[model samples]
Target: MVVACCFGMIEVVCVEAKDIQSAGLGPVTLAIDSGSCTGLTGPSGSGKTRLLRCLADLDCHEGDVSLNGASRESFTPPEWRTQVGLLPAESFWWSERVLDHFPYKQKPELDSLDLSPVVFEQPLRQLSSGQRQRLALLRLLANQPKVLLLDEPTANLDQDNIMRVEALIAAYRNQHRCCVIWVTHDRAQLERVADRSLTMANGRLDGDSS
Candidate 1:
């Protein structure tokens, strides 16, 4: 899809991973178009998470990953991470107060996740797992990343909250035309959110007929 960037109406291939290989996984190549979501499903140890880490340049792996046609090597690690953000299955909070981790206190994105502004005043240890998960997502979105690598983003939430998170993600993708690589175990979720689905087995990905 065409997006209006600083250069004015440029064609951006949101994400492209060429010959990506990590422990147990074979060479994997895939391209995710702008404003699209790709569902990745696989067994517990099938390297699904590893693949995302590789794409985020978080893990040591052999691959060529590019965002908006710019190679991973072109940017500093922090710069690249800001543009291609990854939300791990379990988020970590380094600060005592929840607000300390965020750059700013006010963000409209918080409301979409059903987070009250008061949450910023609470201690990180007081928040439940589900709350932390939702907050993590909000933090990621606040960066306005060009691509999102989400690993089981809704795993800790109830059905209602899961739908809320999904809706927020879909809205974000539509607004920014960003690419999403979502790792999910729920086939129904894949059907609901993804434009395409792929299954990983023994470190290799294949198209999913389901």
Candidate 2:
């Protein structure tokens, strides 16, 4: 719970979780600094996705999570989600039309993900899996979230698209000072994007690498 106090404002840790306990994971503690990316990697079924769900408050868990020094309790579930956006392995779309899922008159930086604006006019069913994945990220970013919980966001993309997605997220982190917890199995991707990386195994975190 260490935090810097300056002029009655706390601008130190961007995200903090204490003793987080959830399905496939338990009693985990970690902190993410503002405007930095932290990579979490491990074998399949190592509880990475559950950890992200717990942090996003989408899964039942025993823990304390806070953003910008404000406890998650301070906001309702929906409100908290707006600040802590989660991009799941597979994104869900409620509307058949691509544009319906996004904010009206709001143009996402589509080019950053190698998407043309015309794609927005197409039907959701017409989009490829990779295209949908990219659009889902853009939709999440449209909220300008302070924290991003990404679960293998580039898994469906090719190498070029992977680079594009990484660059886009890096740019967002730089421009908005967004805190990120990127869960991936790609060691190469981890090295490229993470300021520091941690390994999770058997419901615990260890093996710190920078």
Candidate 3:
């Protein structure tokens, strides 16, 4: 039941997959906490996205998903979303200027994370792949959610940007004391950030903490 050892301020968290029957995920269970730093490695079509969507209440399912002690169903969609935020594989921007998307006035955190200052002036469509990834993560962090669900966040970035994004995520989690459910196929990325590792095979999550 103890997935990892907790150190400093991180708390222990557990997720039990009772029955993923109708949703096609079957009965699966997994638990993760702080200081594990493991990753989830799986091939395509493994239902990683589906599992994350279910937890975010983006899809309906038969099993129960609780955070702390409250069930996901207990909160309204907006309320639930504010508590549990999901950052998709592809980032979105509505305005031509990159800075138009963010609401915060001062983002010293963005600079500390190694994001380029030019990113604020350039159009979203004109940015390179690494820029987009950092922008997406910045937007998500600005929301200050209690839980974060990330899907391949750094897949398109270079080594420098990848490390920056990893450090940013770790800083956000530590500062906010948030629970992160990251879905990634990159073993190195997982080792760099995750506190625990899990794999999805045939619609079930098995605890593979190594």
Best by lDDT: 2
- Candidate topping TM-score: 2
Better of 1 and 3 by TM-score: 1
What would the per-residue lDDT of candidate 2 be over residues 1-210, giving only the tens digit for each residue? 343533344548999999999877978999998888999999888888999999999999998999988999999999899899999999899988777777784777788889988886888888999999999999999988999999999999999999999999999998898899999999999989998998999888977787
TM-score of 2: 0.93
TM-score of 3: 0.83
Scanning candidate 1 in windows of ten residues, the lowest lDDT window is 1-10
Q: In every candidate, how many clashes are there?
A: 0, 0, 3
Global lDDT of model 2: 0.90
lDDT ranking of the models: 2, 1, 3
Cα-based lDDT at residue 108, candidate 1: 44
Ranking of predictions according to TM-score: 2, 1, 3
Candidate 3 contains a number of clashing pairs equal to 3
For candidate 1, the C-alpha RMSD (Å) to the true structure equals 3.3
Task: State each model's CA lDDT, in order.
Answer: 0.87, 0.90, 0.70
TM for every model, in the order presented, reads 0.91, 0.93, 0.83
Considering only N, C-alpha and C atoms within 3 Å, which residue pairs clash in candidate 3? 36-195, 37-194, 37-195
